[model samples]
Target chain A: MRHLTDDEIQGYLDNHPDSDREKIRAHLDICGQCRSNLENYQIIAGQLNTDHIPALSPGFTDAVLSAIKPDTQDVPVEEPSRLIAWMSAAAVFILGIASTIYFTGSSVAKNIIALFSPANITEPSFVSRYKEYISGIDLDLTLVFAVALVLAVIALIDRMIKRRHKPVSFMI
Target chain B: MDDKTSIVRKIVAGDKRAFRLLVDEYQRLVNHIAFRMVSNPGDREDICQDIFMRVYQNLAGFRHDSRLSTWIARIAYNCCIDYLNKNNIPFIDEEFDETISNMPGGSITPEQQLYKSDISNLLQKEIGLLPVKFRAIITLYHLDEMSYAEIGDIMSMPEGTVKNYLFRARRLLRDRLMLKYGEEELRQ
Candidate 1:
């Protein structure tokens, strides 16, 4: 006959308080480790069987319930985190820069026209060249408006695309 | 109304006084379970109160299919387990020392009931150090004198599993106690 495994002996050891039970009896005869383990389990179980439950503190239950229960009238309001505040600030800055470029573009075009007026005709001098160079700022400002418009359009399109697709957090 | 159903009705009717009625009855039971699971009075108190307050808030959602005690016991057990995992607090709550100190050997109680035999003391310490579930299984099955069926109800586990836990908990208890026995226990 095949001998009982350690698990069966362990199982028997756990369920049977009497160490002298037949299955445990047979197993212990042959296996020293099983015998030792069984004996140890008994000693432990015996000790545990006598344990006392802890006493309740004075008004302990009431104290605990009171401590954790939120006030009925005034639930605490939650504040948004720092990251959200930073994102809002960045959005405001970007909008300000774009608005500045848009408003300045027309004024820049008017100044470029004024700078080219014919009354001041010292055409061959370095100062005229320097003035022309200086006059380019208006065109450059218009160019900034153009670039800003393109960037705003691209950003809008990007936002629209992202919104349409709407990266949803799906959990399976 | 059936007991749990009546309690539910009272809590739902917004009878704040009825809330205390529920607490008075279930507090010891929940505290006992939490105390066993966490092994600390303070942490056990925290867990016990958490379970009840959760019950209070979620009372409207309570279905009367299962016993209220069982439902709340599950809550108590789960909260203790969560606290252990979240804080890595080693299942034995800080208040466990207070409970341990109050145990038969551990407590200074003059009551004969508090007087722990040496072997019992060794076993208590080991159970105190075991995992929360192991501690709970022993407390419910042996300490509370609950049957496997009752334990199954409290834990929402099958009776077979409760038996398994009880046996394992007992064996573990035995092994730990034997360690302190030296050769004297063996020779005996």
Candidate 2:
């Protein structure tokens, strides 16, 4: 008969249910070489079976507990005053732009009016012409442009804030 | 109704004390995986903490498909692997011959190096020298006493693969010990 393989020997040592323990035992009883191999493997298994894991330092649990943020799942409520301030500022800017468009009759205002007018919907060529006209016109619309940029920045910041405070679901 | 379900519910309901208890329960298992897979001592603590934190974050997604310990171990294992990848550490699955032949007994105490007869210490050094995955398998199998199927779930491998790696790991460890100290000393 062929001698037992290492797997069989280990399976025997491990008392693995699938291993033919009686067969392996019979072999080991007669086979000195396989028996020696079993003995050596047993020693290795003995060393591995020992609890060699080092203990983590004291207060590991407390440190982790302390690090956990409280109410992590709760969404932070946005301040109503901040929201009001943003809305008021936006309203003031829109009012300023409306006043400028009404009083100045600026060519920029004409293009802006044309860009939104219902009459321009049917005239496809008016879209490209409007773009060309707006690009060519040198209006002193720095205030308007600056206000629009600020509003955009404010909207982006609001989105970021909302995202940061979004409530996490407790269950999937 | 069961203890695990109740504990998980308490934790999901934002119970800090329950979370603390959960951390206490699994810290040893987490530490074993972290220490076995990650070599850097300095990063081990942080990695362990991160593992627990991740467990907390993802606990809501736990679907009662596996044991809580097994789920936590899977988190710990993945966290260590991610740390290894992020740090550009070589977690290769290469054969152990070159590595074992090349690896010196890992950073040992001067006294340990001097005596060199402590079999447990030698075994630990050899374990450290194994490929990361093998070290993890050894820890999960022998230290944690986890079932092969549970280890398979934790490591995202088949049970057969886990068994093969475990057998190969033991064989390599045995062969190395035998070669170094001979059968007589090991038999003792």
Q: What DockQ values do the models have? A: 0.15, 0.28
Please, what is the TM-score per model?
A: 0.50, 0.70
CA shift of B13, model 1, Å: 1.6
Model 1 regions more than 4 Å off: A1-51, A64-172, B39-41, B89-117, B147-159, B182-188
The sequence of per-residue lDDT tens digits that candidate 2 reaches over residues B102-121 is 65653445765554578888
**Please, what are the lDDT tens digits per residue for candidate 2 over residues A34-89?**
99988887787778878887878888998887677645644444453576467657
Model 2 residue A30 distance off true place after TM-score fit, in angstroms: 1.7
Please give, for residues B74-118, the per-residue lDDT of candidate 1 as tens digits: 777777778778877775432433232343333324542342344
Chain A TM-scores of all predicted models: 0.27, 0.42
Name the docking class for model 2.
acceptable
TM-score of chain A of 1: 0.27
